[model samples]
Target: MEQSSKKSALSEKDGVNQPQSLSNSSVEVIKQMRRKQPSAQELIDGILAKDKVALSRAITLVESTNPEHLEKANTIIQACLPHANKSIRIGITGVPGVGKSTFIEAFGKHITSLGRKVAVLAVDPSSTISHGSILGDKTRMEELVKDENAFIRPSASGETLGGVARKTRETIILCEACGFDTIIIETVGVGQSETAVHSMVDFFLLLKISGAGDELQGIKRGIMEMADAIVINKADGDNIAKAKLAKTEFNRALHLFPAKQSGWIPTAATCSSYTKEGIDTVWKTISDYFELVKTNHYFEEKRQNQNQFWMMETINEQLKSNFYNHPEIIKLLEENKKAVQNDEISPFAAAINLLGKYFKS
Candidate 1:
C-alpha cells in the first residue's frame, strides 16, 4: 500500500525524481537549437529555402563587428547575391507627424494581399545613439508583424552612419534571398538619413500631412526633388478637401524642380491609413514608374551605377575604419586634433600629416 501510494501521488518523491513529461529527444532538440549558431552554408541553404530564422541569423552576422565573422558574412552574401536584385527596393521618408508607421502597416498589408512577400526595414534615430532600437512603430505594427508574409527590422546599430547603411544594404540581399518581393525602407527621421536611404532604393516616396496652412512649410526642396511620389496622408472625413489642395500644391512644386534623369515625372497623391483609401493608387503609381524605367532601360543602369557607387563607399568606409583603428594613428590623431584645436597647427596640415603617417605605417 505504501509503495502504491508513493507511486500514484504526484509528489517530489516520485514525480520530481522521475518526470515522465521530460522527453530526452525534446531536451536534446532544445539544447541543439540553443547551442549552435548555424554556419554560412547552412544559413545560405536556409535562406534559399525561405526560412525567416536563417534570414534573420544571416542579417545578424552581417551586422556583427566581430572580425572573425567577416569572412563567413561575406560567404553568405556572395551566395545570396544571385538571388538578390529580384525585388523592388522602395524608400519612404517623412517628418515625424506624417504617420509613417500607420501608412507603412496599411501599405504592407495591401502588398501582402496581392500575394507578395514584403520586408520593412526602418532607419530609426534611436538605433544610432543606443545599440537597441526604440522605434514605437514596431509596436504599432502589430497586424503587419503578425502577418506571415511580412518581416520588419529596425536599423542595425553601427560605429558609423555609413556602417549602418552598409548593414541595411546587405540585409536587403538576405531578404531577397528569403523570397521577399517588396522591400520598403522607412527613414524615421529627417536630414541626411533620407539621402542615405535614397541611394539604396529604386523608388523614393515622400509622405506628408495636409492642412499645414502653408501647404509646404518645413518641407525641404532637396527632398521634394528626390521624391518619385509625394503622398498626402490623413485624407479622410473633413480633411479630404485639404488633402486634395495640398496634393495640388505638391504637384506644382514638383514641376518647379528639374526633370528627373530617368525621364519619369514625379506625381502627387493622397491616402488615409485609417480608411486605407488611395493605397492602391499609390502602388499603381509605383508600378507605373517601374514599367517606365524598365522599358527605357534606366532601371538596370541605375542599379548598376548604384552598385559601383556603394563599392567605392565601402572602400572609403574600410579605409577610414582601418586608419582610425590603427594603434599608432589613434595616438597621433588625438595629438593632432588637440594641436589643431589649440591653433598650433592648421586643420588641413594636421589632416595631411595624419594621412602621410597612416600610409607610411
Candidate 2:
C-alpha cells in the first residue's frame, strides 16, 4: 500500500510538469502564427487601423527581395495610395556626431506633444562586408520610443547610396497611409545622402553644430544650398555663444545665394536638445515654410515633380536589374571581363559585345 501511494505521488508530479510543457508549446504556437506571413488585405487593414505590428510587417514586406513578398508589397502600397500624400514629409540630414539622434528625440517629442502622429524613418549605415544595418537609432531615441504618438523605425539593411535606403520613398508612402500627420526621414548624414533626401521631402533641414572651423568640417557646399532651414543644435552652456555666432554666419551665407523658387528665404536657428531650449523656434520655422510654399502653389508642384522623378528612377533601376540578371548576360560578362583584363579585348569592345549578347538573349 505504501509503494502504491508513492507511485501515485510521482504520477501527480509528472502531471504537474506536463502542464508547463503544454504552456510552452502553446506560447510557441502563438509566436508561429504571428510570424506567419499576413495577407495583403490583412496588412492594409491593420495599417489603416494604426496597428504597429501590421505596419512593421508591411514595411518588411516592401523591403523584401523575395518575389512573392514583392508582389504583395506592391498590392498593399497600391491599396494605401489614396490614403497617402496627406502628411508633411520632412528630411533631416547632418554629418555624423553632430547629435542628429539627440536633436531628433527632442524635436519628435515636441511634435508629438502637439497631438500629431510622428513617424521617424531613420537610415543607418550598413556593413559593407555583412550587408547588415547597425540599427542604433532605436536605442538612441529612447524618449520618442516611449511616446504613444511616435513611431521610430531603424534603417533597413540593403543597397544604399548617399546614406538613403533604396526603398525609402515607398516606405514614406506607407507611413503617410498609417495616418501619421508628420513624417521625418533621417538620412545617413553623409553629404551625398542629402541630395536623395531633398528630392523627397517638403522641407529639407540641415542640422549643424557650432565651432566646426572654416570649411564647416567637410560639409559639401551643394548641401548647404539645398537646405530650407539650417538648425544649430546643442546650444546650451559654453556652446551657446558659438552657436549664436554660427547662426549669424549661416544667415549671412544664405543671403549670398540666389532666391529660392518658393520665394522663401532659408532661415537659421539655434537649439539645445538637452534642455529643450529653442526647440519651438525650429518648429515655427518649418510651419512658416509650409504656409509660404502652400500659398504660392509650390508645394503641389514640387510633389508632382517628385512623383515623376521616382517613376523614371524606377524604370532605370528595373532596366539595370533586367540586364544584369539575365542568364546569358551573366555568362558573357564573366568571359568579357577576363578578356578585357587580359588585354585580349578593348574595354569598349567588351561592353559592346556584352550588350549584343544581352539583347539577343
TM-scores, each model vs. reference:
0.87, 0.91
Q: What is the lDDT for 268 in model 2?
A: 83
lDDT of 1 by residue, 1-361 (tens): 3555445455455244656878999999999988987889999999999998888888888878788787899999999999999999999988787899899999999999999999998766645445665656669899999999999887643444532345888999999989999999987655667777888899999998887654757245877888899899999999999999898888887878889999999989999999999999999999999999999999999999989988998899899889989999999989999999999999999999999998998
Each prediction's number of clashing residue pairs: 0, 1
lDDT of 2 at 251: 85
> Per-residue lDDT for 42 in model 1?
97
Judge candidate 2 at residue 337 and give its lDDT.
90
Model 1 shows how many backbone clashes?
0
Q: Assess candidate 1 and give its lDDT.
A: 0.86
Give me the displacement of residue 93 in model 1, in angstroms: 0.5
lDDT of 2 by residue, 106-225 (tens): 999999998999999998888788887779998999889999899998875367677688888999889889989899999888677888889999999988888776325523468878
Q: Which stretches of candidate 2 lie over 4 Å from their true place?
A: 1-23, 214-220
* Residue 265 displacement (Å), model 1: 1.3
